[model samples]
Target: MINPLGIVITVLYYKIAEKIKKISIFSKIPPIVIAGVMLIATLEIFDIDYDIYNESAKYLTIILIPATIALGYPIYKNIELLKKNKRIIYTGFIIAAVIAILTTYVVAKMCNTEFIVIESMLPKSVTAPMAVEISKGIGAIPELTACIVALTGIFGGVFGHKILKLIKVKSDVAIGLSIGAASHVIGTARCIEEKRESQVVMASVALVIVGIITAIIIPLFIYLIK
Candidate 1:
């Protein structure tokens, strides 16, 4: 029998790509729509008759790294601006990252969730792939971490622009910080769409800063909870 996930992903990936190419709205890249289609395709098409499919997915996931790396060129183009606004970019990212981990930890503890679960939730503010790696390093559930990451991304992508506008966050630097701090890669996409080159650079800085902060803090929080 043909692998179902392969068939489904093969079909829908192209469809989604086509839709994205043709559309020009926020709905074009809704994470829910993308992820929902992916999940549904996985279940319906992938036979799951054995554990091999799970193993194959690992190799597939590795391909995403190159895409992440491609983001670096854009950052390189704006490196001069980054050098100038170093303080603002670093300061905002550190504050946002710390708050994200601390808030998740405190809330998880208050709700009596296990330490590992909290550790998993700690990286929810980052991109999903990065969140999964961070979760694994800290002994958290990667799958659960992925779900949280997706939810965070969707929420950020869907409402972040409106929220910034409502709050009168007019500065491109500030807007970029908010998107990177809150939504990770999805937010970066939003920043670039506004034609703000500096904001895009700041968004990259925000993700890096937040990723580093989460890496150091999440593990310590897990230890403390243990």
Candidate 2:
């Protein structure tokens, strides 16, 4: 039942991907993305069932609970930042959630995208765990929601800073919120890569607030539109 080899392979894939991530051209690509791709390739080559892999590696998912709680550290360190700009920060999260959902919905409708896809993508900007639950609650495909969320995060993490700089927006809070609201934890991880504690702290908070805000509105919006 406990397949140690699956655990070893999973960790090894991620470790190798992390090393690959150090390359300048590959720097923007997150290790998880690379590791996930490689793992999929390996599984297909070996004809391994995903169930076997997931059963062994499910323990890793538990670590996310503590990792999420640890984000409170940055918030504690930067509590003053929130205290000083609670209005702006809260407003930003709300605006970001509303815009992300509205735009996705409108565009998908215009494009005649599938109902299932639109529902799944409605929460694409949210973090995986919350996004998955939202997808289910809204009667969407959780698997598709997870994939779209990952891609959205990757896109935001890779280009968020570059796009901000291109526009001459240098404020860490703005940058963090933009990336975090758009991409969730992966974009926040990009903030970590930049070593800007200001960015990281704000980003971590952005995803949480934005996630909550999105979760509340999306189901209501779906019900209204459908």
> Number of the top candidate by TM-score?
2
Model 2 weakest 10-residue run by lDDT: 62-71
Model 2, 1-226: lDDT tens digits are: 4668877988899999999989989887778789989988998999989888888887776575576556557567767777878898889989999999999999999999999999999998988878877888888998789788989999998788999999999999999988999999899998998999888888888887788789999989988987
* TM per candidate: 0.80, 0.84
Give the clashing residue pairs of candidate 2, or none.
none
Instruction: Give candidate 1's error at residue 39 in angstroms.
Output: 3.4
Error of 1 at 13 (Å): 2.8
Q: Among these predicted structures, which one has the highest lDDT? A: 2
Estimate every model's Cα lDDT from 0 to 1.
0.73, 0.87
How badly does each model clash, as a count of residue pairs?
4, 0
Whole-model alpha-carbon lDDT for candidate 2: 0.87
Against the true structure, candidate 1 reaches a TM-score of 0.80
For model 2, give the RMSD to the true fold.
Answer: 2.6
Pairs of residues clashing in candidate 1: 4-45, 4-46, 5-45, 5-46
Which portions of model 1 miss their true places by more than 4 Å?
1-28, 31-36, 44-50, 64-76
